[model samples]
Target: MGMFERTASVFDDAMVLDEEYQPDKIRERDEELEQYRQALQPIIDNRPLSNIFVYGKTGTGKTVATRYMIDHLQEDAEHYDDVALSITWVGCENLSSSYQVAVALVNELRSSDHQISTTGHSQQAVFNMLYTELDKIGGTVLIVLDEIDNIGSDDDILYGLPRARANGYIEDARPLVIGISNDFQFKENLSPKVRDTLCEAEILFPPYDATELNSILYPRAEKAFYDDVLADDVVPLCSAFAAQDTGSARQALRLLYLAGKRVADNGETNVTGDHVRGAKEELHQSKVIEGMQKLTTQGHAVLLTLASHTANSETPVRTRDLYDRYKTVTEKIDADTIVERRVRAHLSDLTMLGLVTVHERNEGLNAGRYHEYELSVQLDSVLEVLSEEQRFDDIVEIVKQQVHGMDRT
Candidate 1:
């Protein structure tokens, strides 16, 4: 037998657990689906188009539910003789500004050969190009912007696209925006005019509870796994773990998938709670490492400072002390030092990333409250990642020395 010989596996249809897979029916989201269907009902009735804003946390079935409703809406609209519908979906996770998003949408609507460059166009020029493409498609055009919050506050496209017909940017196309976001603050921070124009029908998808996750996971497992492969406690354990963490159906499915993969890799037949727990830890560590790897150089410097203090058993240190140590680390590497306020910002970001924890200390009325920061992750993990960079070698050694000195003390 060859080294890469095939082996018997448990997965029957692993794609069922994939993030991009759209199930024929979306379970546990009937209420959201009904609201979504009504939001699109105007297009079927040949009435004026309505812009929709969808809000939810990650893995709450927002994108899948929207895709499901869009598929059904297109099928239903086929019955009407006068209704002509065109749909364009663009994921804005990587596109950070309105300009980038506009370029993305324009390319999405255009054919492969006619696609415009992502750069070199003015904001208005890109908007014009988008308007032209929409006009070419004509009729009711639905533009779905997924992860729309990545655009931040640069929302000119959101304001202009929804009112394109009224603004005479496009005569033939009645284009409406469908903005999907996981951030609730993005909606609140939108300019009133843009919010009013883009959010005619707002739909919210709440996170899935354990029961809902179970209802979703069982059918998927039935299709994804072979008979007798999953132990009785596998699905429930995965669901409960995900529910307690983020209430994400996607996370639950991912846990189950990873658990089965672990069993398959170990040449085992049954997946149990133990497998689920192991998979959860693997997933978590993978995420932490990935998050750490994506940090800016200054962010890594800030983390290394914290790690050094942690090694010295001196953590839960305030920003002032951290700044002094951080400046020392940056200087050792000949990197420019940022202001104390900016270091605080980096710490704030690290806290959000689950790499650091902060505690607010309240003093008497004479003294104002302050925050102390500490490494929330394993010190060795942070050091391992930071050690990958050659520039940080000197500082990594210093952190190791701190650990050794503490051991001797």
Candidate 2:
């Protein structure tokens, strides 16, 4: 057979399992959908729109549910003459501040040929341009900002846009800001003024439970695979594993897709629980490597220290001990060493990234308390990623020697 020739496979429509594929209807989200509909009811009633804040963890269907509701809202509004609904959607993942977000909004609202440059405009100038665009649309407008937490604490746009009418920024357009974020703390950290104006309607989307995930995966699996191609336990195993890890529907679907792909690659007809387990490991290693690759040089040094100790079975090592090893690694690389306090901060970052786990210990008032850290990932995985960087070759070798010496002793 030619290299690209078709072979025996299981997938009938693999794209159904993709992240961008929106199911005809969102599953197991009636409660959230109802709440969302209620939040958007004012627009249908010809009343002023309420600013809404949506909170949920990643893969909890926040974006998908929002799109679904907006679609329905737009269709329903057409029956009424008064409601001239216009929608603008912007992903804020790469936009870091209110200024950048405002600039992006202007570009999104403008025609391709009329779009403004991202720079060279003052903040007030950008706001004026955004207001002008909104006025031109001149109706009940829904501005959807996904991953809004990326704008961080600079929330001038969040505060300004929602209150545009009251602040006399615009007259013809009634704009409602709907901000979606995966970080729980983003809402809490907003300025009080911004909180009051932007979060007029707050909706929370909880992560999916195992049963919910099972419901979501079954249909996608049926569409993605041929008849009797998935073992009975395959979907259940994927759902259970994802629920235990993050309760993410996206993860569950990905697990199912990977399992089926593995079976198809092996020239087999059935995707088994074993294939699911193997796929889970592959996803985990991929996640670890991706996370590690995004780290800074100092972050890598701190992680390498933890990984080396982990390989020697010496973890749950104290902060001071880890700091000593971290300093040694930095010195060998001819990089300036940061203070121990800063080292602790890097460890905290690693902990947040799920690469390291930390525990607090107290041995009485005199001894006070301190934290101990260890690699939460497989040592082999960490070593594999670090080995790819030429700067870490000498450090990786030292780590191997330490492990070998410990084994001999």
Candidate 3:
């Protein structure tokens, strides 16, 4: 390679191995892929495929593998004109309500040549319009609702599909549904009727074992980086750590990229084990910032206060003590001070977001239940994305001490 090309390669090499670089056709999951394929096999046979529920931890290839199967089914179903396949994939988070989902599905089904009103229609009318469209197409409809648990009215969407078939809305067309979620209790929360209809076929994607991750990542790494660029031990280390957490191929790829970037940033010629260690730290920081971004302003502020107080404190603070610190923080920003009840609510939000962890205790005698909360990720990591006033270099030292219990003067 020429000198300039080689120089560019350093950054490029890192990014090429990223999950963003992953192709839709390529995935490391074989068993899960086949199971999804079998689940949709009835749909291909022009029979009513049972509504499927796919459950797994996030980044475990559940979403990707499910999509992959749908793509293949779409391609393979071209032979039969009798088998008109219409698939609507919706991310439930973006469409939280049944009305919103109906609108989205209606808008998706309509052609640019044909104008369909997505607004000013009653929620029931929108669902009717959707059913009419499905009938107009006159074939089997497959709706894949990703993160279906995010839909505020999951039952409205889940139960609505099978019921559409039951009610003879689309008389000639059969509808099959696939619901995907990371929340384990999402199914339990569903109404009995919805659960019965949606769980006709259940597929659970377990975390990738180390062997599977290693096999899956090897080809991706080879395609992503220059030959012989990464040390012999780097890939295995990445695999081992990823398998331990969630066995997410996405996480493995991300870690690989982070490791390579760490090496390149340090002016190293090749990626090494130390690079992997740095990548783990960088990944931890990125996760914290992401968690902070998802919080409301009050939630973010609560976490920032926790970060600030924890920046110098020797131990995790009790919930009451943390609220005292939070009140002082609210005053500094000229924000209305929230009562302890509200502060408690925000703290729970923070814990759910994975920004902070709660330790519950039941003491002996009259001592009642209380919580001691601590940051899950380093304080410095969250400060970067939060308001600048909250950012501090001391946060880096604080995290180092908290995580490693190191004595840093």
Candidate 4:
């Protein structure tokens, strides 16, 4: 066997150990981490904890930092009998109603080794069960609602629970809430009463700088990869790429892992600039398409048509024009759908998902600009995925016609 083959047989260390990396081991967010911990320290000490709203763009380590601090708080809570720390973490997206939330709480409480309940019960009954459980435990119970914005339709859980503890309904347990959200507009849209209670302490985690990201990457990389597998430049590249949206440590870590895998797959012992570049290209392509796929089927239809039309066109297409093309395609498919306004809704969704970008230009300073949509992902990459479907030819033809018409117009 060759020397490299011998090394591969011997060296089996991986750069990323698991899907969830530990926060204590996370580098370069010392200030951010310390500030976050300080905000929740009162709760840990059996003092009243404020309901903190953490906001940032996606992957800024907001969730990770919050989880880490809370975990520490849980440990610290054990020593203080005055501070009864019970943590129930709920993701708002999974359950839509207050009833669902109550059920989720009871289920989580029951499943926990803390072992709050085991019997079958109604949602309301489960909530009562939870309340009793909280009362039994006493002291401060921290309810962490991750992606709290997704609890939209029945936000009564959010609106009511804090007040329940505040108004002496539980009588024993003082509940502290930490709500985490990616949506910038979440606070503005919340009911005035909900905002009054939920906004007591708001901590915003901004994106990580290159320096901070390097701090985070070094330890994680060192733990996950062989010594000297990554160059000094790789962390900076990952940080710079992720910084614009949200200085996402998660994204940087993901990119690093993918880059390492790319090198390993290509039969290299070490990761290099070429592997990093290739990972970026592959990640961008996959991210756009996968993100698009995650959208509603209607949203996918909107994208398929928009991308196809753009590919066939000589120039970028406007929203109104795309609506016209979409109408024709929907009719051919015999689907009953909403009109242009709803199409604009799907357009906005697509824009947010980064499948397409919207450019606005105003004729004069006073006159407001109008938006024109353009594909952010490669048109062919999108089409290649769509082409696997049965109606690919028909979809292609419609787009081609629209393009030719735009040229003639």
Candidate 5:
């Protein structure tokens, strides 16, 4: 075969590892799908439909499962004249409020050439427009709002859609809402009225365990890679690492994809355990950077303190030490300084993000206990990611010099 004749010596189709690729079959989520089916059956029957609230951590098959079940539902509903199912799928991540969501929906349903501007209307007016558009669809409309927690505290869409028919806002359509959220506390933040309606049938999708992730990746490995492209134990190793990291099937697939790509690019015939190791580290660094991109000024500052210490020989650094370094960091960056107490809270947030590990130490019960924290990730990864933020560039440079100077000392 010519050197460049084939796109890959390994992958038959790499899309099987893609995040957007829907598997022909969903693995390890049979029970969750069954429960989702029960929650959805009423809509197929043209009965009063229950609004759904689904909660799960990232990459746990919540979105995929929802899409899979609804695909089957929509396909089945085609046979019935009474069941006119119109599915409106919205990702609420970028559309942060009820107003924005309503306008987006209105535009989605409107004639393409006649779409209205997204702003300049009152929230109620935008909602009225949404109701008008839904009435036009005139069916059992299942609105799947993924990342529904993006609305923060103002979940007017949830509160309004469930009651749209009864309140006479939407005359012809019976609207059912399916809200999928990754944020665990989002439902708790909803007002009781919104919560009761939106969470009428709640489904929680748990993270996948090691065995489950292995099961998920095995078939994809078969489809994506040529026969025997992956060396022995590579799939299991990917599964184990992902299970330990986040128990996310998506993460496992990504590791496989990255490793396969590495082997292909390097003209290697086999994807090995070493390739998986490198891929996992690359994925970890990317995830940490992505997570850091979401942090606030204070979050970045507190993390910098930990990274700065880790750059030096110090680790399992005390909270007081973190606060002290954080104070210096905030001053250098010209960012608004947060109090030590608030820095403690930011430390907790950083800990939750898995950027750092925390340990509680008791002062032998004679004095009050305090906490210690260390960077859970590599200091190099932290500095690289934070360097992307312009305000933090100066600080990262300072830390780079600090580490270099420490080395010389």
Candidate 6:
């Protein structure tokens, strides 16, 4: 009794549910793993390493599984004396072009004092330096470039790295390039010579199903919360919602983690369906907020117009009607007046951004075909986002008044 203790906690280890947590075993990826293993077999055999390209949607265990297998490859290769393996893993997202990537890899291999600047070298000079660094290692190198498509159309590295030894660029080292991407079309757009070498063995990871997501989340939940903290229905609800969204295992885990946090913060036991729903709303709000931050001035105006219509009615708003609202909002906010055609285009862009939903309506005879737009997010949330921008605050109040009737169809 001398020492006071805190209240009972809900979490055992929250980081287990984090995005960066690499599980010792990957669930629902057995066949993918086997394919991955075969692709990397050349490296283990001390033969010429084959280039690999892995394609998968986000949260499909591509990065984690690759890291897992490569880690094992590094560990197992230690027993063999002939195989001199060096791994350079580059996240191409941070490197914009082939030149930057070359400079980055070259710097990555050097000691701190010997590093080069991010600029000040021609692309060829940087390539030369990178090859020099690779030759110094004088071994078989596996270059794992994650999100390789982030380099945009600059495909020099794609063409250069695979043929570095044959082209007399790297005299001693043999480089094996592995490209990973979430965008499938990026590979299709590659130059043929670049494509043939980098696309040696392509592995596609499909999105997870509800059952698979549930299977993936259970182990994480077991490790994240106390046995009695989570209700029976929590996992199923999270899995179903994520499966509905994109069949993403990461989304399911994040939902569970967020819901658990919500319950614990409220000092409640047994995370219920209410908590799960609350978590979903919070996540959706945050996602919309992030997406909104990236919109242009006209984009925001178009979105606000659609949101105004959606909040006021039970029915969807037509393209022409939505354009009128957009013009009104732009005028009130003292913004530029865009044409109806531009406004219609903005609606399509908004739909693509997932900020708005659209449906094609075939009108009987004279009305012809038209599209309708609706806000995909809650009205109050979108309004809140708009209010944060001082320029829109005044007009946003008027828009809110227009939405308060809620009787229009």
| Highest lDDT against the true fold, candidate | 1
Residue 389 alpha-carbon offset, candidate 1, angstroms: 1.6
Query: For residues 1-409, could you state the per-residue lDDT of candidate 4 as single tens digits?
Result: 6655433511244525344655465455577777777878887565666778888777777777777888887888788776667778887676656677776776666645654333355555666677777787777778888887776645677776787766666888877778888887888878788888889877777778767777777766776776776777876787666665457777777777788878766777777666777778888878777776566656767877687667665236777778887877766655566678899999998888878888887777775667788887776677666655555557756665665676787
Segments in model 4 whose C-alpha atoms lie over 4 Å from true places: 1-19, 43-45, 111-126, 166-168, 291-380, 388-409
lDDT (Cα, 0-100) at 41 in candidate 3: 86
| True lDDT of residue 119, candidate 1 | 79
Q: In model 3, what are the clashing residue pairs, if there are any?
A: none
Cα shift from native, residue 234, model 6 (Å):
1.9
- As for candidate 2, its clashing pairs are none
RMSD in Å for all candidates: 3.9, 3.9, 5.9, 6.2, 4.2, 3.7
Q: After superposition, how far is residue 325 of candidate 2 from its true place, in Å?
A: 6.5
Taken over the whole model, the C-alpha lDDT of each candidate is 0.91, 0.90, 0.76, 0.72, 0.87, 0.86
Candidate 6 deviation (Cα RMSD):
3.7
TM-score of candidate 3 relative to the true fold: 0.76
Query: Candidate 2 has what TM-score?
Result: 0.85
Instruction: Give the higher-lDDT candidate: 2 or 5.
Output: 2
- Clash totals for all candidate models: 0, 0, 0, 7, 0, 0
Lowest lDDT 10-residue stretch of candidate 5: 1-10
**lDDT value, residue 12 of candidate 3:** 39
Residues 1-409 of candidate 6: C-alpha lDDT, one tens digit per residue: 5588665768889999999998888899999989999999888787667799999889888899899989999998899899889999888788779888888898888889999998788999989888898999988888989998888878999999889899888888989888999898988788888888888899998999899998999998999998888888999999999999988888998999999899888888789878899999888878878888778888888877776776667449888887777777888888998888888887787888788888899988978899977787778878888887788888778778877655453
lDDT of 6: 0.86
Clashes of 4: 7
Q: Considering only N, C-alpha and C atoms within 3 Å, which residue pairs clash in candidate 1?
A: none
Among all candidates shown, the one with the greatest TM-score: 6
TM-score of predicted structure 4: 0.74
Ten-residue segment with the worst summed lDDT in candidate 1?
361-370
Q: How far out, in Å, is residue 230 in model 5? A: 1.4
Clashing pairs in 5: none
lDDT, candidate 1, residue 325?
92
